[model samples]
Target: MPESCRSRELPASLLTNPEMVRACRARDFARVFRLVKVYAGIYPSMIARRCELTPSRVGEVMSGRRQLQHMDVIERIADGLRIPGHMLGLARRTWETPLALATDGRTTPQSVASDPVAPASLPGAEVDSILTLTSRTDPSPSMLQALRSSIEDYWRRDDQHGGEALRPAVLGQLRYVVGLLKENRPAAIRHGLYGVAAELARLTGWTYFDALQYNQARAYFTEALQLSKEIDDRQFMANVLACMSLQATYQEKPADALALVNAAQDEARAAPGTTPRVLSMLSLREAFAHASLGNRYATHASIGEAHRHFDQIQRGDTDPAWVTYFDEPKLIVDTGIAHGRLGEAATAEPLIAEALRRENSTNQRGRAFHAFWLARTQLGLGKLDQACQTATDALEPAASVASERVAGHLREFYDELAPHREEPVATAFESRLRVALPMRVSGSPRP
Candidate 1:
């Protein structure tokens, strides 16, 4: 192990610290991460490397954007940070003696339990009474308001931090909303709950898709569709199907993506009061699908229609929350990307740069993505020095963020830069890449 690896022999004082024990028992990973940093004197990147996770993932957990739920992750945290096994709800530390051996030959070790004693089981009648009492208390107006606020917060965070960092917590909220549906509530409340639940499911699906977890994304999209149908909300359902269509576009199923977007348009036509913003987003996806298929004429037509619809969207329009992010800047950047894919780098370069300039600094993931695109465009234009510099600028964000899309773009940039490897600028970029990213080497060609 490297000298930077956390030692298992954490100081005895920290091991027995009351606050550390409490934080662990509460599953407050942020607190635990901080305690480990403060006590173990290790960097977040070192902890991430030791745990075999992305640095942004560690930051996400510490920032409450992701939860440490999986047993494997929990165990890795214990092992990497040298946290006490008992602190992570595990058996006693390996150094501790076994308390018993099962007939199956498994050793059960005793742990110093710091939590208070368990409560006594209720009598059968009391249990029934408690259940009835709980079910009678439907999800409150305040609770629904708070969850909506949380959903909006999730959207904003996802915009800034990217989907990989937000998926776990978003999924947790989805599960909670689903559970809320099972409770007794008024018809109106149930209807409202359906709306929020459907949005959450769609958001979760979008995040999962962004993270490149296709199967999980599909599952959430299916659930979102079902929830939307339950409320008979055609507009909302159209939006979700549009989301699915966008995912299909990225998954390389251009035909399927086109079909889904067409379906979304059909649903929008039937919607009672679908906003122009929603229609514009669906049109944008249609353009994306066409671009994937190399149908330049159709792609241009769809883009034109999208622009028209977007122009119709007035301020104070009652558009869905999800579609609010689809502004002129997004349309321009996406159009540039479409043109770039078709080998129109000359036309793509300025548009992409303009969009990047307007983009907010807090959106690190977005910056990385656009920066990669700009680098690729510069490379296509044979501006090797600029390309190398732009690509190098992308590396810092790529190193710390857990984004499969950004990572994939970086790989493609490396491949594109391969032929130019003998160039000094390319060589310098590779050297920086080797230190900045965990990607495979792109220095020498394979024989």
Candidate 2:
């Protein structure tokens, strides 16, 4: 073995962290070897020499063939490597258990640690058979259907409960589907899988963004955009770009947001017979970006474009599944908020009121968004009491759901009300607002 590969005294702390144990159990040999190598730089090799085995034994353990038989040998290895007794035991236990591939095709063993159940329904059987077959053959129609059904199940769970309950499962399913798609090289499967991947990435990004993990969200969105491009689905690409723009705007990067919106607009223009809803959505993103940059004229121009696009969209036009929720009234509400941000209270107030009224007949998630933005507009107009009430209303549904955008709007509304707390209207608003909004341990509104 090379001198650099020699083991040395390490810290007990390394073994305690579950991530490290997982790394070892998964046979991440390079990582384990590299960690020991790094430790050698800080400690002398004499401590390692005291152990019966050399650095090569550590390598053997990581490579999964070495059976640790003696307690003294394990102890000396732990002592030399500075791994804690309990953690060393855990590492040994993990090593003994055969590492199983997760359903997602990741090398990590399934955390649930239960026996596999047989497929129950036709769909389940189809998925099982496809997964088994794809281990050898190309993806078939049954495989595509199974994958699509799984994706649909994720959506159904999200719609019925909320993203919080479904996100982890959805992410695992996405990884599994991607693995299957990669393993089987059929064109149809690839195309379907790309669409599914883009959607999953978009959802994952949105979920992480809600959790205030911006970097993680951006990584997912970046992957989503790349997948959208691969499928040549202009509408999906535009939507993904719009989502990226929203993330940028929220992060206070207005210029980057505008750039994304512009790119999306170009993509929409190139798309054949694009639906009005999609065009309006792209325009809405552009308007928001312009408003964030304090470009009132550009914002208004974009708002107008948004309305024009919404007007042109026919009722029965084919739209992407993701965008089907948006309609003419929804487009109007979105444009109205853009106007509100541009300081057009006269034009915004009635539109906001109409949106709130329409929301009563809409989905919970959409209603929450409508309420949030309306509250924002109300705050802008110095209608503190109404703003607070609207904000409280918005938060009611949002608290039960897993949407970052809705929660963010509510937070912004709270921030806008912060400076005027002494005023009677603001005071009244604050009393109720504080109770409705989720707060951190520091008693500050959650971002």
Candidate 3:
């Protein structure tokens, strides 16, 4: 490992290096590895960590013994190394791609849409390329219905199989939706398309977030927020913001999470008839942010506010599909999570237990998370044996699912149990957990 490449980011020495850019653009992993070595500033160990590969695997890729073929691994490399997705046969990078400067010389944030026939950024026949690939016909009611049905199916599958299992399909659906947006259509259909597209984007974002892919998640959420804003869909915007806030909360940016939830609440309030349930969900996220900050009073107040709103939700009331999932069971689990974060384990225990019981078998991810929390609460209450048993139970369902969030909580539970390793029960639990959830190295590496 190169000593100079200790930091995750590219050292200043390689930031403006042309060889780095050329290798990246060509999607040449071996060439990129060679250039890093030649530059004498990047380490194979660091690359291994960034790409979620072992040092030996990194060496294999560099030595032409292994190929970077899987889309997931390719995405990791592109994202880790800041390679443009277009360079690797992808529609667009998961993170923001720099736009060609507008006529005013300011970098444009919006996609180039002035000439729908051909976007300004496309250098060649890519316009015709995707259209041909998608092979979409003119927009129609049936097409819209098909798209909505697909989104619903993907959402249902996500709830059952977790994000990592459904991310690719959701991403593909999103790309197809984007292609439809380019076609000329009636105002109503176009608006509907945008609405569903926004939902799809949000759903994809959530899946990425569940997998702990923060950059991709944030980018998709940003796209959803922008689409909702274009249609003045304040309610949808609030939901997207709430999702972003939740991600921030989990990422340990409590202040930023609070700010985001505040913005979401404001937006929800402005919507024509935002449902009480929707507002309650946002309020719950606010409580979560407060709990993360160790603000007991604020957290309790927010929890109360959330319950009040939740109580006002009438059955059979019209609501978007997304907020409909914020039923009593969800509220209980979220409240338990907030209280648990505040170290009120006794207060959290029963609620988490009840939520675990109430969650459907299809919701394996939720069950795993709630089960882990129940164990954590047990630990906090000094019920060491119960905690160990509950944590062991949590791992089975979690192992069957593909959610990084569940994996993360399980890892935290393990860390909390570290001091008890000498105990036989703790030792057995640790042994099982290590097999179920191996620890990833801790550090964020930007390319």
Estimated TM-score for each candidate: 0.70, 0.67, 0.70
lDDT of 1 by residue, 1-447 (tens): 554333445677877898987787556788887887798765676667656556766776788765555566776677665676655546444544344442335555444333223224323544544644564436878878888898999877776667665655665566557757875788888988888889888987887787888886888898899999998998888888888888898789999999999999999989987888888888878888998899989988998898899889888789877777777777788878878866779988998889988977677778889899999999999999999999898887766666777777887888888899999999999888887863445443320
User: lDDT tens digits, residues 1-447, model 3?
Assistant: 543334334454564576765565435688887776667445686666555556666776798765454467777776665455644435466453355432446665554222112222322344434543564468788888888888888877777778665665566566566657776889988898898889989998998899898987898899999988878999999999999999998899999999999999999999998999998999999999999999999999999999999999887778888787888999999999999999899899999988888887787777888998899899989999999999888877887777888878877777788778799999888777666655432332100
What is candidate 3's TM-score against the reference? 0.70
Error of 1 at 426 (Å): 1.5
What candidate 3 gets wrong by more than 4 Å, as runs, is 1-136, 434-447
Which candidate would rank higher by TM-score, 1 or 2?
1
Colliding residue pairs in candidate 2: none
Alpha-carbon local distance difference test for all models: 0.77, 0.66, 0.78
Best by lDDT: 3
Candidate 3: residue 4 Cα off by (Å): 39
Clashing residue pairs in all predictions, respectively, total 0, 0, 0
Ranking by lDDT: 3, 1, 2
Tell me which of candidates 2 and 3 scores higher on lDDT. 3
Model 2 per-residue lDDT tens digits across residues 384-420: 7787777766656765666666666766766777787
lDDT value, residue 354 of candidate 1: 91
